[model samples]
Target: EVKAIHYHPENTICDCCQCQMTEIGTTIVREEAEFIPARMEKVQHIEHAYECKNCKADLSQKAQIKRGKSPQPPIQRSIAGPSVLAKVIYDKFVQYLPLYRQVKEWERYGLNTNDKNLSNWVIRASHDWLLPIYERMKNIMLEKSILHVDETYGQIINRSDGKSGQSNAYNWVYRSVPCQGPTIVLFQSSLSRARSVLEGFIEDYSGTIVCDGYSAYDKIEGITFANCWAHVRRYWLKADSKNGRIGVKYCDELFRLEREFKHLSPSKRRKKRQKHSKPLVDEFLAWVENSPFYGKNALAKAAEYTLNRANGLKAFLDDGRIEIDNNPAENAIRPNVIGRKNWLFSVSEAGAKANAICLSIAETAKANGVDFYQYLVKLLRDLPNLDIHRNPEIINNYLPWSKTIQAECVK
Candidate 1:
């Protein structure tokens, strides 16, 4: 049972006459949310000490002694606890609170921590603690037959040169399609937008990737490309005022047909798409081929854009698993876009890569119905005690889809 201790003021003496003032019985006059200032304390953990004084005095007898193992620090050798690290990760990443802003907040809460320490904890935790989960998510995503991929630009401060903001990078997102098993979004940070990023991402995996018609994706062989119709519609939308009505009408008819196949089984969906949607796509491509417009004309260029990507655009027609567009990948990458505004840029390419790893964990956890704070708390608390190298299966237990993780983190 819990009990409350009520505090009351003592009887006051009159300043002038030294007479006791009237006293009111101790009772709470008001109940309100109390603003208790944050407090910090250094806790000394004492290991049990065992000693036999009689044996110690006896030279012939050996002394019996024992000292317990010390508690592990969340970030090795740092004075931060698991909950402290969780709050730091949550505020900086999930809440998008910048490090400088957090410094002031922590100061108010009696921490007085600088940005460097915070950055150090994040980088170390991300690399040593979170990366295994990232790799696991990456493997699971690559296991799928259909994946959606997209790219977004981000800045990395203090590049190879000393000065900052001299270089740019891309956050490449690879994720499973909606029709797949457990959803996972993996972020990769690359200094260049070269096809090598995609090449290394899907090295041996030969699967259909739905994406926008970027030439980088075209260079990768042994993979089927399904282009985004949303991208195509955006082109038409841009040119709508300038003779894009016909193209817009064609896109509308195509989407209308697509909605009808939403709930159909894979094989059945493919059949329905072939019967009803295939002709519309073929007719749309024909219209583009029949019409001629110069690059200067917006409407003509939109038509030509569709014409050039027609092969990728119609890829979904061959299979039900492939989506008409790569919007899911775009949607998955959007959180990075939102986070880019806050915290602005990463300090280095290495830091940018670390950011990707952490983001992959956060986004993948959300996709798998895992609570963000709970996941970080568990990761920070348990990883210290776990010998991941000795037992490779331990990390698997922490995966978002695992029963342990789900039971602990899913809300």
Candidate 2:
């Protein structure tokens, strides 16, 4: 498709001939992209009803009336539609736009709606439609053998636990390793960052968990912790001493070896690490144990931290599927962290949970190369029609990696 730029009648005349100039053909001078600002329009549905004439003619007989099937609104008793709700979710979760700001954006589009109405739409949609999908994602994610876990701070303004709402809260993120399968990033909002939080999320599960040197992950039964080497390097990086430099060197060498073996098959990668990385690991641990610094110094602190979690740091050697760092989980959780900076805090605990659900869907869709807005639109439009709660398996068809979903939602 092509668009023509029109000139004024006076300008269309040829200056040299003083005659009218006509377009013989078009020239491909240049090409550029254009953005059209979005505008809103009102949509009204008028369902037609039909009645049997014969039955109507017989006054004693009841008339058979049939009504046309109308499409359901994404949210009942609200003006919001599937596309509208998708935009709100996309702006707030993906673009990090807050509700008050989005209210202003709606005004620009000639729709005057307050932040309270927007919040209600999101909360109701998440509770009614999105929560089922979130749960299904969680169940499938936990089925994978290799998982990465991390957490960051979150706040809520209304308390449910009888404590001040201003008190601290946390958002825990768990994701399946990319190598294992289609990545699933799930977020959980909780009042505590205790080990119990993680334990409850992965109940009765047994697998490798790659994570930072957080003590809360220490000795959870049936779980193997592959502690992050990058975290260990951070301690050494902060230590302002000659030995600290040596510690960093050891870490760097191990990382370099991992990068070289990145393209190898898991079994082959395991072989390469055992042959090359194991020696460096042994040597680095020896250096940390024998370091001269002690008591209140950076070097001592680094060594103590290293030796304490030495086993977990070495756990990656036995399995190639586990990464040398928890960077995947960190990168996954960073969106929420960045959004937290903009939105500030959830108005209530329920709102925080809704935030987690929305973020999970958006991030999971992104990991699978699906357009976030399109995927949300798909879910919001389709899920309402399915008996998702009774037949939970129906959600499997709509997951980010499903064949139909990939074809439909990936851009």
Candidate 3:
């Protein structure tokens, strides 16, 4: 066997000694160089200047001279244009990017901003530009034949009365119609009372309202209520998870009926209810009435839920207009819930209010088939220039469902 030598990879290695090169072992040399090129001195030349036409004076002769047209005052550079700003505010506030994150993004683009200033811009844009459209949407929601209502908790820091640093409020969402797509959501800050918020919204309106079993919904006069079967079925399913036979049976029957309902078209559903569903509903009612488990513990609770709200659950079958569930309203409010996860909470009540306004505009624009960004940009720019009396009709032009506006939108 022959012995082979190996060399390690380094900047310098002595081939004979196999020693690593150090800084002490070497010296760096700086070389100086000079290049001589032919050089020549240039002669100065001057041109004759003309006189100013307006002043009839020599212009260039003077060391300092003013031009005829002075530069216009510099228009301040905003981080974004009106349209871009509206989009940024909409995405950050309504779609829920906390301002600090937005500021960091802008910083990456070489623009500096703080959360407070961004918040102020959002408040101003929403209050001044977006609120009118939101109000219009609410008015449209009120006029619909049926409305779906639901409430969710919202937290606001520094709430009224100064009791605590944080307090719970309500975001009450109302959906006017489905498929045709007219929906509205309203946020109201309250200390856990639904009556004040619900009443305040629908005071002038009297129509059929679909909701889950909430006591606050009970007080509205002249408004018919339809309970969500989904809610009742959900409890039965919960009980079924715990291996309750009665719950399983009830849930199976409910799921079968719901499946049947799903198979029918909206118009066919209305007609079929009188012929087919009426009989199924009658059988279900009799089953509930005759069951030995009607007054038992967990099964009894599910039974009572169905029995007590039997009329409301059946109300949807009678009217084709009423939905099988309060899902439309729930769907409308879902974006807010998604946004809240990113935003965490509002800094103030005003911030929350601004958020509501932006959400209303964005959602309504979507419902109406309008491009939200374009619509918001147009509104922000034109709203300030609008004359309240003369421009009353102008606002109508922006309405999502208005025939004239819809025609323009289609075109």
Candidate 4:
């Protein structure tokens, strides 16, 4: 319920005047200005008339004003500044917000805006302003000694086939040198084939790639694959749900190994695996080889799981450089999945590409220990004047790993 408070002026006698002073009324003043409708009035022009009486002729002169070129009206309708616009775009595309809902929220505030304009701004700004940062991030990722690669399905509308139904697409994210910063995310669209996207992104990247058993990653040449232990354990947990006793034993063993892994830092974990975990891995392998667990009805499942992922599991034991899981890549891709729930799908190929670029910057900023909002604002403000070839430092500043340079210098 809304309530109004009224204040009445108190009547007092002026001692100096020796008369009663009646307070006629009271006025209320507001501390802050309130919003009022814009007042627009039509302007009128009047001409002055002059007469020359000496020449017996009446002359009328019209006012002729010298006018310069009219300045273009500012875009007053925008409640958000360029920085705010960049942030909103990042939140909507990288963070994910449906346009229709954003429109409704703006309407509630007495500001009228359409989702179409916002979408166009996001796409145009991402392609024109943010694409360089995205490219540089990918290049940095390729330079890393270790990387994780993964792909997830992305739905799209208005595909090339002219079909009304949604199309199956993919977002491929790659991160390099994740521990030391400057992580990168690369997104690409593919029908179903993962090899093409992975191969294309990591064409020159030859190093350890941690991934799941997607089979499509097999096509990459000279690249060592380190399988995720989480995937392996997931299978064991599933099997335990059906076959109780055997499943429980395997799950307990895997859980114990993971607990050991959690106690070490990323770098220390790698070294500890070589020291203490190697012996355990050897014993586990020998047990698998000798036990009936590999000979029963579950033999095929156990064999396939052990044989295919044996190298990946042992890689950590042999070299302290490999990770036990492909969690970094999965963590990077998680945001895109959550965003899909809100925005649903991209309208076109271009829109998807834009979404990928914005997400790359946001995620990379976070990885580099930079604020996403501040970094995005800098991108929007400085990108228009940025010359990528000559002014490569601008690109470097946005890289997650490149932090020696000061923020003031980039601006």
Whole-model alpha-carbon lDDT for candidate 3: 0.68
Residue-wise C-alpha lDDT for candidate 1, range 144-247, written one tens digit per residue: 88999999998987676454485667899998966788888899988778998889988888888899978887846678888999889888888857458778
Q: After superposition, how far is residue 50 of candidate 4 from its true place, in Å?
A: 34
Model 3, span 27-107: residue lDDT tens: 334445555543323323334454546554555455443444322211123334465567566677456787777877666
Weakest 10 consecutive residues, lDDT, candidate 1?
Answer: 1-10
Q: List the residue pairs that clash in candidate 4.
A: 182-400, 182-401
Ranking by TM-score: 2, 1, 3, 4
What are the candidates' C-alpha RMSDs?
5.8, 2.1, 14.1, 9.8
Candidate 2's C-alpha runs over 4 A off are 8-34, 58-62
Model 2 CA lDDT for position 3: 68
- Give the Cα-based TM-score of candidate 2 against the true structure: 0.94
Question: Ranking by lDDT, best first?
Answer: 2, 1, 3, 4
TM-score of model 4 relative to the true fold? Answer: 0.72
lDDT of 4 by residue, 30-148 (tens): 44545655332332334455544544442455444444332221123434455546656756855567777777665665557798877777777787667877777677677777887
Clashes of each: 0, 0, 0, 2
TM-score of each: 0.87, 0.94, 0.73, 0.72
lDDT of each: 0.84, 0.90, 0.68, 0.66
TM-score quality measure for candidate 3: 0.73
The alpha-carbon deviation from the true structure for residue 4 of candidate 2, after best TM-score superposition, in angstroms, is 1.9
Q: Which candidate has the highest TM-score of all?
A: 2
Candidate 2: tens digits of C-alpha lDDT, residues 125-167: 9988888888888888888888999999989988788778778
- Model 3: weakest 10-residue lDDT segment is 69-78
